[model samples]
Target: MQKKVNLASAGISAEESQLFRESITGAKPIAQDKIPPVVAPRKLKRRTDVLAKALDDNLFYFSDEFEGYIAEGVSLSWTKSGDDPHLTGRLRRGEFQPQVILDLHGMTTREAKAELAGLLAYCAKQHINCACVVHGKGLGILAKKVPNWLIQHPNVRAFHTAPKTWGKHGALLLLLSVED
Candidate 1:
């Protein structure tokens, strides 16, 4: 038990003590004197094995010999057969800003494929509809292969060579399908 002390003896003026008492006149003491312990939130584990398996089994096997050859300094554009006619035009015009950008610079074809798959997977998970893929103009290997890979992906609704400001000849803007 705690002993009650006199406010006057504690150097508190009578008026100040009266004001304090008045302020707490209707307040009741809290029944519990102790604070509840805080617990840390559980960490979420990433399923890298499953993602890797899916990437290897499902995303690989892109055709190395695509029928059409993309020439350097030229634009690339394509839209799914049933998609809106204006989709490619919209992409070309930069109407849909890229929510994510995957730069495939300095990566091998194998590495680029894995990264492209990962980017699409992330976009699908996040419900992002627009993305940009920058495949630099060095030797035009990725520049050509990127379009071929993108065209094969089921989620890619449309893609077009980005306009002057957005990596003109070296990048492609993608419109992805985010529907259920």
Candidate 2:
């Protein structure tokens, strides 16, 4: 297929276009590893506040695990619930403990915050498989800032939006593992 352009003064003919295509034909496809993974913003329910602070304090003992991934401005003293298992999937973080949150409809942000830490610690203590977080999709409660907070939390495994049958992204399915 010779794609010719009428460059009359240059003296280049239609046949020359074929050479340009042939020169690049042997290039290999790019490998998958060359690209970085893309993560989406997930939903998290935050109704409780007082408990959130307690959970923040609770994580203080495990300062070593909070070594690298924390946000620069966030205080080391300030811990979010489920802050124990941040990014545990690929590291030598030890146990595979998990926890779940159920039916977070009427709970206040304070309640939710408190409950998150309590649940995380409980799950870690039990060495459970995984827990279900039930944050029903209502009037944009946790959609604003809760998930972002959880994203930085230490105990979190990998939380994604809940399935339709499981209350959708209004709820987050938390996976907890032991701290390294």
Candidate 3:
């Protein structure tokens, strides 16, 4: 035999039913003419200065902004010491194939700096020796800045302009120091 379930025990009372009926009756039908018109959402304007400031906060930017500027269309190469005799030749001749490549063509200055730092850290963790950074030969902002950043990094041994077959002046070949 099944027991009967009492709905009143579920907390619903006659007062509640009366209140619900009153609420339903109180709500009058809204006329079509009285209805509010739908409005389109306003578009937000982005401030470039705010974005630039935010990017600057996290990136490893040069303290002296004037130092990273290079002449347009000029090729650049740098070696820390004279001991690495073959590094320049190898970088120029495209002998040392890059195990990792980072392209900074379309990135903003702040984004490129962060990316370059991340790339070096990644290469160091993985023991990657040969790396390449393609900064393009545009106005030379990246070409100039990338070299400066590379030179400052302790893990970077040497960097040179890529050969004609490997992006030439538009790219750089980096020799990373493997940490024990």
Candidate 4:
């Protein structure tokens, strides 16, 4: 008892009406043999603007946790994600012995920088546990620069003031990350 309805008279285009019929009744068995209609794809606008001010800003500045200062004479310690809780304590108690000693005493800043980078890379590769960097007690460039440089490196797990026998504030005990 359904009444006949003229969709075209109601303002639907022929193509729209055909689409509606296909939606309601599905495709006819004979029409399954025919190819689908060629529809032009909708044009999408590409996003050009970026939220980051610079590339480094996106990579390093994402952390909400304060990357605290590493002042001269103050012990610097940092544990990367998943390090054991007692590791820093063991380092503090002079338990993890320094496997390698790097003395930055008289070298120029440029020379010290290169040596530090090379030594750290070597330590990470060889899986060295502890290393001591002797930067001397005098208010020299190495005392300030060494701590700052170590803080920035990705492989440095933690560093602290060495025990009295190991040079006190003149040296720093470093815990290197072991490769998986």
Candidate 5:
């Protein structure tokens, strides 16, 4: 019992009505005009627990027996045993530019350890070979501890106290072994 409607009465001209009909001549009727809903993919979360566990087990232990003595105003430099001896020299010469810099100013030993682990993890993930760590020269606490912590990490191939332009005694240029 639908009421009959006229195109002319609806204000459509005959030429326009004819053109519309011609345009849709081969079209089939749609049973449903509703669009389907889209579902977004889930994002993956990083496993900080595993990373923390590894850091705790490997990086936190600093042996008092192992003496890494550094006199005030002296630049620090070290290279892993069996690595190229020239690597330390190259680091000292400032051949490698730091891709990232970590400032550990005013951070406690615990906080610095956590931040250092995070930075190393990030550098490994990003395949960064060079990094600068600024531990400042206030009390020389971090200045001493930073080297000990770095020596523990296997990724650290070599490290040299930054050049005069780069923080000198207050910062270190690290050469990391990044897996390709």
Candidate 6:
């Protein structure tokens, strides 16, 4: 002899049963077309300043911005001297240097540029002089933009495409300028 389970003890009451039946069987839902949706079309946010400077319809190419960047050079004198032994300096320090690496995967030119600016700002704030940006293999996207952008940035002293183990073709070892 087995005992039957009482559903009422499970907290499902008669009122809930009545409500469910009324909602499913007695209710006639209004047509979707009869209801007006509450929403407006959104406007696109664009940067007029960037558009004005970018001669090409596209903003990522090596344009005058890059050319001008190459013309001017990193002026701040940075030495391999700093209290933080972990931070990479202007010159190669002994093994204690930290690998300051930035990853820019899945970023548009505008976003990447902004991020690069942020990194520069970070380096400036932290007094970090050297860092690496891992861009990922020639995913064939954001390719030229990374190098050219760094080339023109005010704080960048020099940058070279990284060799294999670090990130191969996808990374750049950047030498940043130190502040006075």
State TM-scores per candidate: 0.67, 0.44, 0.62, 0.56, 0.65, 0.47
The predicted structure with the larger TM-score, 2 or 4, is 4
How high is the lDDT of residue 107 in model 3?
A: 95
Q: Rank the candidates by lDDT, best first.
A: 1, 5, 3, 4, 6, 2
lDDT per residue (tens digit) for residues 112-145 in model 4: 7666776786787788978998988676568767
Model 2: lowest-lDDT 10 consecutive positions = 70-79
What lDDT score goes with residue 41 in model 4? Answer: 100
Query: Quick one: ranking by TM-score, best first?
Result: 1, 5, 3, 4, 6, 2
TM-score of 1: 0.67
- Please list the Cα RMSD from the true structure of every candidate, rounded to 1 decimal place: 13.0, 22.6, 14.9, 16.6, 11.4, 16.8
| lDDT digits (tens) for residues 65-162 of candidate 3 | 54643544456777776548678777888889999889898999977888887788789789999988899988878877788777776777888888
lDDT of 5 by residue, 44-142 (tens): 988999977877755554453455645444878888988988886888888999999999998998788788888898899899999999999999888
Between candidates 3 and 6, the lDDT winner: 3
Model 6 Cα shift for residue 80 (angstroms) = 18
lDDT per residue (tens digit) for residues 118-180 in model 6: 777678779897777777655545555676666555676656555455565676667777896
Superposition TM-score, candidate 3 onto the true structure: 0.62
Model 3 lDDT, residue 48, Cα: 84
Relative to the unseen true structure, what is the C-alpha lDDT of residue 85 in candidate 3, on a scale of 0 to 100? 64
TM-score of model number 4: 0.56
Better of 5 and 6 by lDDT: 5
Please write out the lDDT profile of model 2 over residues 1-180, one tens digit for every residue.
997566555686656756767888989988777666788978886757876577777544332222333323211112235454343331213232223455667888667656655666777677764555665557655443345445555665565444444454465555655644
lDDT of 2: 0.53
Model 4 misplaced regions, further than 4 Å: 1-68, 72-74, 81-86
Clashes of 5: 0
